[model samples]
Target: MNNDVVVIGAGPAGMAAAIQASSLGLKALVLDEQPAPGGQRFRAIEQRYRRLRAAGKGLPASEQKGLDLIRRFRESDTRFVDQASVWDISPGGRQISYLHHGRSFTIPANAVVAAPGAYERPVPLEGWHLPGVMSAGAAQTMLKMSGHPVKGRIVLLGCGPLLLLTARQLSNAGANVVGLLQTTGPADFLRATPYLPAALRSATLLKQGLQLLTQTPLVPKVFSLTQASIIGADHVEGVNYRSRGGSGFIECDAVLLHFGVIPNTQLSRLAGVAHDWNEQQECWQPVVDAWQETSAENLMVAGDGGGILGDEAAEMSGRLSILRIAHRLGRISDQSLSKLAAPLQRGLKRLAAARALIDTIFHTPETMLIPSGDTVVCRCEEVTAAEIAAANASGASGLRHLKVQTRVGMGPCRAQMCSMAAMAMITPGIRCGQRPPPPATVRAPIRPLTIGQLAEADVEI
Candidate 1:
């Protein structure tokens, strides 16, 4: 029940941290919600490769590095608990309570690494709640894990690297990609020229971006789209988008929307870690030191969960966190830690520069951030944009007031689905100078558990 360290998540960051910690002689246990490791980026990679190879499909270069990382992680002595849903962590990051195999257990730990990754920023649009509509990341998960191709013609809407990557992955998987609609244009990339050198410093990342941009099979890709809407009732029938050429419609079976990704900060928030908003990324992030330690002693957060950096940065952050933890445990010398931290610090700076460029190039379009008056913002509560606007007009101050008056964030998702949109409506101009507000309060039982399961809990203090 006791360990030197407990790492939450099995993604690149978590795996890297746990492997490093274990190799340093720390008793590290890695817990992940997925039945397999690799997180979303490498979701079910091993099984997917086997299935694809059996079907005469070769592994895509996009997934090669991740596969190698996962392989190395698996070879490590780190203990892994797959499908372990961590619900809460005790004060000071000493213990964690998680549900595994229908049982609850509280494991004590000296240090905790929270590597919960990021999720797509939910962009609301007309008819977005209809069937056949999903986040672009979800579509990629389906394809990556089970080789489940999207049924019928699909339209990819919105911006970010994920959209382009998903489009390419789907097309390569034989899905009929109807269209690729982007909210940002060449102007956005041109605007990011000053940061281009930093972004291009990593040849691998530059090559990946080039491949995704050029490899998509969809033709006539539209850019600078505005007033994009999903036109369907019970199911997705088609998509409506506007550009300089005026409005147009694309008949498709489904619409995959993704503006960008925001860190998954619920767990860190629940752990009472101090967080601040990243104005450029427009998301909440845990306040971490250069060593990746959070304000709460012994608690570390890495990966996209801490911010919106890409996988490479996440891996480096994870290693940096583990190195710090290892040094704290006397597993590594101070001199060694200092030497190790230097390179990670440099890598993080380069990555930060690159991320700034990426964020600018694919900044979530203002139109997407602020949905139309009639658009459904909170799909779970069936709350519309007008309703939230009415609440704000009636003197609602911020996300808390809006949530109380309009029940916008009280749904099953607990604000994950609608918090960003509601916050945007309240603060129309979110910039750096403005003091960033903390995220909504996160209570215990972060993930839903049945009443009966809770009653049967066997967690020890």
Candidate 2:
């Protein structure tokens, strides 16, 4: 189907983009992998909101805001397809390919907004492959979608606001939170002090973060963690950790890990969009302009897919990205676009002021980024850190070379889970003024699909 714009997510950014596109008199089609709207940050908000309301309970402030956005999206004239997994976008952003209901379809669009969002940065440690060891985001997803806490004694480890938030959520959900382990310490906070003034500009966010820290369950907490390993053979038994204060082991059935989040750049890269390494966030993100338009003519990346901006900023950036598309399509005049974009730009600037401090304070520990010995860096391929190190030592120059040498990123997940860690291992140090290696190459069939499914794809050429 032909449309003015196709939005490739249903999160805050995607929803906001579609809503803005419709307001500008443009037909927008939003394709999202979730069964409903509200991306990971607000996963299953609608269903949970309804259930809680019926039970005479109210949703969290953040979730209620997400539900409000979802309601607006549902009320808009823009069309949306849920449970649609977009696997490819033609170069130059002219066509979209997605799988829905076990069938593949290609559609033409004038412009595409990629808001694939972010995923938790993987922290590869010993025995992390054990069952019941998952990312904090995964645990949060379980809590949000099903209102069920993860079973048994749990140890929440790693850094980032999400770690604390997930711990609080799980604790409130009646999970047996045995311990909280933080990789960040006083040194990181000291490093972040320079950015505190800017962060203070968003007092509401600071207050919320403080609340999360103080209101979390009173459990044994360890800070300045240098290393962690799951002490399990088949399933999670406990977590062995080392911190500045001391080293200890926490008996737990589940270990939830979180370091931070990185942009989901697979689709953007597949579309041949140029990306640059964000030194601050220590991840590769699609290069976008002030308006969120990528190097490709009509493709834009919004929200965390472009970079790890929070959900509120994602919504603002999403609206900002569509303003340019709407203007280019003649749906809005120059003056109209300028007027419409002014407030969103202001909001984005305000939200971004705090990101520096957040990134600094929660920077992924160096040890976790480049694990050594038998730690499995690539879970899908079972590639260990020593294998990657050995390959790099044997002349694996970059991501491509490493992939060829050791198959570190050729797994079913297509480097999504392992690329960052592998890159960390391959390039342990970079000389000053030297450009870091480009991200792994992205190709079609970004998501796995059967050969028969590809052959039966409905083409709209």
Residue by residue across 301-327, what tens digits does model 2's lDDT show?
999999987998999999998899878
Give the local distance difference test score of model 1. 0.86
Q: Which stretches of candidate 1 lie over 4 Å from their true place?
A: 55-57, 431-437
lDDT of 1 by residue, 1-461 (tens): 56788999999899889878867888889999999989988888899888878989877776778888898888898889999999888766887889999888777778899999999999889999999999999999888767778889899999999999889889877899989999878788899899888888877777877787788775558888877888887799999888755789999999999998999998888888788878888888889999889999889999999988888888889989989888888889989998988999899888887788889988767777787578999988999999999998899878888888988988889899988888888777675365534567778788778888888888665
Please give each candidate's TM-score: 0.96, 0.98
Worst 10 residues of 2 by lDDT: 426-435
lDDT values for all models:
0.86, 0.89
Q: After TM-score superposition, what is the CA distance of residue 318 in candidate 2 from its true location, in Å?
A: 0.8
In candidate 2, the residue pairs with backbone N, CA or C atoms under 3 Å apart (3 or more residues apart, or in different chains) clash, namely: none
**Number of backbone-clashing residue pairs for each candidate, in the order shown:** 0, 0
Q: How big is the positional error of residue 114 in model 2, measured in Å on the Cα after superposition?
A: 0.7
Supply the TM-score for candidate 2.
Answer: 0.98
User: Quick one: best TM-score, which candidate?
Assistant: 2
